[model samples]
Target: MKYLLSNLKIDINNKIYLKDPESSDLGKRIIEHSIQLIDDIGFDSFTFKKLGIIIGSNESSIYRYFESKHKLLLYLTSWYWAWLEYQLVFSTTNVTNSNEKLDKAIDILTRTIESDSTFAHIDEVTLSRVVINEYSKSYLTKEVDDENKDGYFSIYKRLVTRLHDMMIEVNPNYKFPHSLASTVLEGALHQHFLKNHFKSLTDCNQKVQPSDYFKHLVFNALDTKT
Candidate 1:
């Protein structure tokens, strides 16, 4: 776990910040601490008071950066998306070939699951509940709707669109369009994470790894042409 956290921190220092170095650094630390807190206490138990205690800063000091808990969550979600965009762009932008692009996309997916500890402590069931709770909130609901927006949502849009276009190139006869694939992929992930705790009446292979299974599902589903 220690090793994983260390490796994940490699390129995170710079991107985690905005502009002002001090506040940026402080925000970064607060975020790092917050992630740990979230993993430890779950999002429900998370509060500015707890974060202030962990970061050695007063509640007022933390509030200076994020006006409210909701705002902080929004920024945290934005940061997660931004970080994902960075990883995807870093791994794929240099490649011109469509196939290589797909491979890089898969690589990013696998690496994130393997390396990041943020999701390690979260069970699928808990994650799903968190998603539902977020949807109940207005700002968070907007973030979900705009997950495909080109600029703020570029990383997400670019990845899905690129893979979708590549799927078309690989197999014109492929029945699933990128949009559908995106829906299935995300829905499956959400369900798997949130529903893992429940017992299944139907026999299923629970041993199959999530990351690798996703890679196979994506490539195989798109392999109709090539």
Candidate 2:
């Protein structure tokens, strides 16, 4: 899978950036260091000037790639979803059984993330943490409606649709496939956040995983045996 993915690129919406960060070294540095900086200081405190100092580049150089920090967040979150979509599609493509396919999709969506070697500049593990901690900031804004119209959230919506389709395959009679699908995706992120920050609010911990809880929730909701 790594070899196959190495040859592929995770595409993000072009409108999210003024330039393609993957297209140049300095651009890539902006992305690489930005992830580290954001992870270290949190999104609210992150700024292009701070990132510029860390990467030894002028703040203006960073703007050439992204219009603002908000757009950068959009790029990161979009990249993560696209990468996960690749994993979901590749892992489940050959599975003939509907139950097994849905099982794999849930596990892929909810399980803890690890670093992917395919993109050395991007630490997926750290990126996942950023997504878990800061993804909502990308969309919880007044401009979100316009951004959605521009297809900035298409990758994420497509991922939800994939899960929705799998749910329908597993249980044709299920009435809320789209809602259940979005819940599993969004709820998994929320559960991970709770497990990390508000431990008392969640049952997932060292032994039980968000994937485990979600699998239980999904199967029972579909009236199917896991």
Candidate 3:
């Protein structure tokens, strides 16, 4: 049986949280405020105390849901990946053309994020910035392997796998589906960074949509050369 994950609210993996933040208004506020705080202050300077002060709650109360800001970052990134997966499923559910489906997937994955009314608590615009700027740091730690063992990257892996499948259907003999999919994701994030810091090194935000550039790259890698 198939499941329609986007028809209803998407569930963030419970492993990423000490307690489910979706369970209460305070819990939801913790997530909502944390995103804003991290967006305003860099993650290195963010703390539960500061978050609590901003949210009008005790610092310890913040810990009731997240063990640390790192875990919270993990949760946010995980949530982004799961939500992206849902967008992929929802957008592709009706399309049958392999190339068109892959194009839509690339567009959804690479394009800028706008808020979705379906998830009112998540400001995807800020969250997308978090993913572009901070997502890599969530795993660039000594505990990365342990976190990986604990399934911290499962949602991200699943998103890569889903897109990789589409690439394989586009080119049955393609040998680097995993590499291609990961490159597309990492490449998109890097393009955003490049546009801000080192604009001349890349042509992503130039005259064309970044998604179009990415679709071009993905097809070229598969030797379809769109």
In terms of TM-score, which candidate is strongest? 2
lDDT of 2 by residue, 123-214 (tens): 99999999999999999999999999999999999999999999999999999999999999999999999999999999999899999999
> Residue 75 of model 3: what lDDT?
91
Residue 188: error of model 1 in Å?
A: 6.3
Q: Candidate 2, which segments miss by more than 4 Å at Cα?
A: none
Q: Would you list the C-alpha lDDT of every candidate in the order shown?
A: 0.53, 0.95, 0.86
Question: For candidate 1, lDDT tens digit of each residue in 1-226?
Answer: 3443335532222222333213466666676676667657766688989998998888777766666665555555444444555566666667787666766665554332434444443232333334333423424455555533424334444556755775676667878767644653354444344434543521223554444555566667776311
What's the CA error at residue 178 for candidate 3, in Å? Answer: 0.3
* Worst 10 contiguous positions by lDDT, candidate 3: 1-10
Arrange candidates by TM-score, highest first: which order? 2, 3, 1
For every model shown, what is its TM-score relative to the native structure? Answer: 0.62, 0.99, 0.94
Runs of candidate 1 exceeding 4 Å displacement: 1-22, 94-97, 110-112, 116-155, 172-176, 184-188, 191-207, 223-226
Which 10-residue window of candidate 2 scores lowest in summed lDDT?
114-123
Taking the tens digit of each residue's C-alpha lDDT, what string does model 3 give over 17-97? 888998899998998888988988878899999999988999999888988899999999999988888889889988898
Better of 2 and 3 by TM-score: 2
